[model samples]
Target: MRTIHAPRLLLLLGTSLLVRGGQTLRSGDHERGDVPGWVMITLMSATLVAVILFMAEEALTTMFKAAMDKVNNP
Candidate 1:
């Protein structure tokens, strides 16, 4: 599963990066000599937080299923 999952996750992240990168680059004002570094940091931070939450939820769900299976068999 790790072999299949890792590649899929990478592909998804790569696609997201390409799309978001274009949007972030285009949304900037051309007159601005430097884009705000803080904004990019914040966006990346938020994305990481969201991904963490999603993974946590998935872990909890797998644990729940395992617990239920053990109970049913015992």
Candidate 2:
């Protein structure tokens, strides 16, 4: 089974909710800002994940393997 980080998931969920709950930008606001809060958060999150994986590929891979081994062998 794959493990999910509950904290990160909840953080993202809460952030999206906050973004949606706030005042919506007008159509003209797109001229000033390229994207909305939620969109920026999503893009930044994906980029952050990619950068983290690139920087810690070996450690993350090892941890994943260890977890998988534990599950499969247990």
TM-score winner: 2
After superposition, which runs of candidate 2 have C-alpha atoms over 4 Å from their true positions?
Answer: 1-42
Q: Where does candidate 2 clash, by residue pair?
A: none
Give the local distance difference test score of model 2: 0.67
Q: Write the per-residue lDDT of candidate 1 for residues 25-59, one digit (tens) a residue.
A: 79875664444464466557756766775679789
lDDT winner among the candidates?
2
Q: After superposition, how far is residue 12 of candidate 2 from its true place, in Å?
A: 22
Report the C-alpha displacement of residue 12, candidate 1, in angstroms: 0.2
Q: In model 1, which regions exceed 4 Å deviation? A: 1-4, 30-74
**Every candidate's CA RMSD:** 6.9, 9.1
